[model samples]
Target: MCSHIFNERNRSFSGREVIMINTDAEGIVVDRPNRFLCIVNITKPVTMESEMVHVHDPGRLEDILYPGNRVLLKRAAEGKRKTKWDLIAGDIMGEWVLVNSSWHRKISEWVIQNKIIPFLNGIDTVIPEKKFGDSRLDFLLMEKEKSIWVEVKGCTLARGSVALFPDAPTIRGRRHLEELIKARNEGHEAVVLILVFRQEAESFSANKVIDPDFALTFSKAIDAGVKVFPLCFSYEENTIHFRSLLPVFQKS
Candidate 1:
């Protein structure tokens, strides 16, 4: 009966816990001055020509943030802010992807609460930003006395049907992988959940070409009993929802 409920929720496309966004405007990317800001030409709410927007993602989005590429922005909710728009997602290679890293935690939490993943089933409690050793993991789920530390990574860069993480070199990400391995060694379950923000990706891998150090660390972490779960999601209009689980392409 519980299994049926979980499967039904996954099948619904939009999960019951989905964050609703009533208003999202389409735009064209004009320029991104830095990691935190972008200039986009709004095409909705009277097509106000050009407006500066807040980019919630800090990673270098070279593949997606090209000039003239279509983007989706949510209007700042009646709040006094420097920018009236927040860049949420953008189109790449004919597919829309959620680029806002800030939403990663919420999406992960929704997945856990809805029991969308098989391994995460039967979780009795979900704690966010749990400190383990010298690192703060994204989530610490408990089932009775057993605990599982999970680190979530948002992957927006892909080549062909393969998705990759840390489009830029990330020393911080490598350290988290090391700590997850340590947790596994100490008799607790450890997992790295890759949120592949793409539509057609069939598999995922650590970006060895961009960050070889992270790639090597990921390999070691998996060998030390750390599990990897890569799930693909699609962005349509104003909604971003999980589509299906993806296989991890092991590096040879």
Candidate 2:
């Protein structure tokens, strides 16, 4: 199991300027004047696009960073270009912080250490590298005893008693449902786990209007023996705990 700790630092953000930093626990500065920087809380874990650090202004990057905040860089892979920069963690003005990668790492570690390992009952297994499958599979879990493939999708967009997925149309998401059906046919226990990070959602369902194909595939997968589990996350200051499993509403 992997673990992470947060370290606070300060820096300057001049609007669109980007800074590069080492992504380790004890964050280190790598470069300056790159693209964009946004404040993040290192104590909390985040994943996917939610981990981005937004630049508020072009000339104020240097004036708004501070300790206790995580930073994100834009154009992280490519070299410096207009309005692009490597994310360097720092404290710029006051109280303004950037999002850090610690949240995602911590959540991943928790899943392995507390959920997956224990559920497998001492069986040895490997965490497969995450990839963009027919849709996008969050994880591919494998073991000698029983083959288990899981797709993890985050449900952050919710309103009142209703919880929705794929706020936007996702062809890739539709493909993932198809893959789940394929995995089930191959005799593996294929499951879809929707991680609802927020506390408001009480139930979950696929948005038919956004992508009807996804809804159809999901219904077929369920009928074909693929288990769908939507679990809620209980959030504390810096830690996230899995709560009781929620029910999935399959309406086609």
Candidate 3:
């Protein structure tokens, strides 16, 4: 078994640290810097003495920033882009920070290789285009030779045993469910994977009051044979581990 100990002030880790456990131990890392815009996880807010500015990186802003995200920062160093600050190394800062462009790619790569790949053998899956049908579906998997269209929803919202999806209402999410339902009718399996970042939620459900249309679409999809799987995992300082699969709670 591998373990990771955080050295917060130095912004580094101990030796042979397990960046991601359980899921894909081989692909996770610690202390590596990535360049991508990230939203601060406002669910776990951090305080800063100085004000930080948000800038646009035209290339990948859409993939990085979310409404309630907070970002990590490094003092402007010599020879770096004037608008950018170095992102912090770990996920547990006082505030949830958006990873910048460079960091975003690293996180995405880590998730795909470490988190997503190891789970593939258990199911037949395909790598769909990042952006599809006005919404990006993470992986299109086929189980029992049946196609399963999945939209990977990353969950950062957690309050003890409760886990919430899309802290803000998502129009794209509604569309994704609609698409999944259509795929189910076409004789394929359609599903959603709520990838919970923290090991807090024991069950998952759509934030219906937050977005009724999403709730309606989710109901229709499940009724039409679209499966919803909520997975929770733990990230100890730097490493990530798969906990247990949680059942999805459908809202009436």
Candidate number of the best TM-score:
1
The C-alpha stretches of model 2 lying farther than 4 A from their native spots are 1-109, 116-123, 130-136
Which candidate has the highest lDDT of all?
1
Global lDDT of model 1: 0.82
**Angstrom error at residue 166, model 1:** 1.4
Q: How do the residues 110-179 of candidate 3 rate in per-residue lDDT, one tens digit apiece? A: 4444444334435635566445456667666555676656676666565456566766577777788887
**Candidate 1 C-alpha lDDT tens digits along 175-224:** 99999999999999998888888777777888999999999998898789
What lDDT score is found at residue 185 in candidate 1? 92
Model 3, position 192: C-alpha lDDT score: 71
Model 1 TM-score, all chains together: 0.89
For lDDT, candidate 1 versus 3, the one ahead is: 1
Candidate 1, superposed: residue stretches over 4 Å from native: 1-18, 78-80
Task: Locate the minimum summed-lDDT window of 10 residues in model 3.
Answer: 23-32
For each predicted model, how many residue pairs clash, with residues at least 3 apart or on different chains?
0, 44, 31
**Residue pairs of candidate 1 with colliding backbone atoms:** none
Error of 3 at 29 (Å): 25
Given candidate 3, what's the lDDT at residue 99? 26
lDDT of 2 by residue, 36-109 (tens): 44433333233333233434333223322433344434334455543333343333322213333324334444
